[model samples]
Target: MRKIPKPTLIAKDVFLECISTVGNLLLKQNYEKCQDLVEAAAQDFDNKFPLLEIYQIPRNLTVLGSIGKEEMKSVYTYRMVKDGMPGNTFYNTLKNSAPYGKCPLCSVRFVETLDHYLPKSLYPILSVVPVNLIPSCSSCNTGKKISFPTNSIEQTFHPYYDDIQDESWIKATLLPYDPFGFNYFVECPDSWEQIKKDRANNHFSSFKLNTLFTAHANEEFRGAKDHMKTLFNLHPDELIKHLDGAFRSRRDQLGINSWQAVMYYCLLKDNWFVQGGVLTF
Candidate 1:
């Protein structure tokens, strides 16, 4: 996953801005009463985030008198998401936080919306909290759904907190097939703790990223298939140099672990693929 710089928006400011637009007097009054609770939840998030202690945060805080979970969620869906609303600016900011508008969750798809890291349906108090929101594509967001963590290890990578961009853990292998198939996986270093490796593996597995990457990787190969065959016929050594350049370009433009980067790495590493195997496609 790509590392995203966290949004600078403050929770109290966003919470107040969102609640200010409520025309309903009763709802506004109830929301006014929960300012401290919302701020506390944000603080709890800030304190626990680095420690993977999200599962310990208070939940279903029935403290928003006359304001149930659904109402609190509307503060985001109705107020913040609507154009020209007070909270809309912050909403857009969070959604655009991903570098180059790519979803940090998968680093594959373009970011389409903001996802609640701690889903607002379950943790209403964090509905507007900047740290709790993540920029993600629709696919990644749908893959996540409203699933919440029950333990530290269950928590997926938080792009802002967990920077895996420089950490090249994704590995792709070119398998024998009519044309070919890619097998993608996460391989952490031996120095990492078992829990950390398991968490990474869980994140990779739960998202079905291997399948996602495989599809994209194959499509990429399809486009390059003819060029590779032509290059090998021109000169096999030239094909090696060309594949090396492709690997370098992808590694430089995208991060090392990107599907394209790993795909090129696999192609360059396998001499048979570069010299003759690619002709199958």
Candidate 2:
């Protein structure tokens, strides 16, 4: 999944107004009103908040349950009011929907439907927390990552918080026509052996990253795949030169258009293409 940069509160007036309207509805237990405010917010960015239907009832119900509690009460309430219908879920989806925040696996540009690193299905309570939201393609969201969990790191990288720049995520090798070619498995360093292994296996199998045929095959990555195929037919040295030039061309043409794509390409440049591997500049 490509990591998108943090968003500025650019739509300050709309954001604030919607937040205030929704917050009051929640306070007054006017759920229908809250939903309408959310619809408006979603409309501001196009009709992007479709998945919001799932979170609405659960969010409202959770808010009702936590109002009187002490510790996490405010946290949840603030999340509810602050996020409301469109607040957290809609905004997050909006950011993800941009061409910038795409899933490397399926290569679809998306908004809020990204699968949580730890599936929100598993941790529904934290669904609205910014830290829990991840922007990924719908195929990556639906085809794979169906309620999977990562025990190694209790939490996955937050697109807004974690510096994913340190990780070699795309370092994974693409296997044969496994239909789920996006499956990325790796041998972990001894220090992070079991955890990394578990993470890899879970990522590989659950996310269907290994599937040779994917929705992305027919859509976004068709050209990249054809290019790779041509390069693959060449000798190692030729392939390296070809790939290097190709990657360079991609960068030149798409110079960091979106935060997510930029981060993904940067990771590939650092970890794979320029790490003294087959590809060289």
Candidate 3:
């Protein structure tokens, strides 16, 4: 996963803007009695989010588009949290910050939308909190729909908080076949505590990262097969060197554990693979 820079927008500003828009809508809904409560709730939300203590925030407000009210057709109908306002600005900033505009959660798909790091449905107070929203591809967003961690240990790696890219953790293995099948997994370092490691594994499983990585790796292997054969034919002795160089290049461009880097490293380290074993596959 790619690391994401913290959003440039101020959380309090975004929260107040949302409160103003939603509060105006609430006023239109004849909920004048609740305005003071809404304002207080908004302030509370703004304060709590930056502390990374979202789990403690209460979900007591009954506003315009809360899930309990069938009158509100969609939770996102609340304009403050809706696209085209601060949400759009936040999304644009995140997308622009990403490497090649790819989703930070998977680093594969193009970022198409935002995922609520804390599901807005559960944490309605943070429905429009800038830091709670994450730029995501449709796949990761849809897959992560409504799932929130109950505690800090269960929390998935936040691209804004956790930077796994600095270290090598992702690993790949080639399966025996004519066109080899690849399996990808997160291999957490021993230095990490069990909770941290478990969370990493949970994040990988929750996002179906392995499945996505394997599909991409297979496509990459197919594309690289002919090139590997050509290179091996020209200079069999230099195949390992070429593969090592490729690994380093990809590692530098992406990260040490990027799929391409791990794949190249594995291929170079495998005696059979460097001798053009992949050619038979």
TM-score of each: 0.95, 0.45, 0.81
Please, what are the lDDT tens digits per residue for candidate 3 over residues 1-281?
A: 88877765665455444334443565434433334444565556446544545556655434544323322213234444357754345546655776788888887789877787766665554555556677789899889622876665557777776788877778888886754688888798999878778878888888887788888888988888788888888888667778889999999998886778888887888888877685685
lDDT of 1 at 180: 70
Clashing pairs in 1: none
User: With candidate 1 superimposed using the best TM-score fit, by how many Å does residue 68's alpha carbon deviate from the native?
Assistant: 2.1
Q: Taking the tens digit of each residue's C-alpha lDDT, what string does model 1 give over 208-256?
A: 7999999999999888879989999998887888888988898999989
State the C-alpha lDDT per candidate.
0.84, 0.40, 0.68
Task: Find the candidate with the highest lDDT and give its number.
Answer: 1
Q: Which residue ranges in model 1 land beyond 4 Å of their true spot?
A: none
Better of 1 and 3 by TM-score: 1
Q: Rank the candidates by lDDT, best first.
A: 1, 3, 2
Q: Could you give the C-alpha RMSD of every candidate to the true structure, in order shown?
A: 1.6, 11.1, 4.0
Model 1's alpha-carbon lDDT is 0.84
Candidate maximizing TM-score: 1
What clash pairs does model 3 have? 178-281, 179-281
User: Would you list the rank order by TM-score, best first?
Assistant: 1, 3, 2
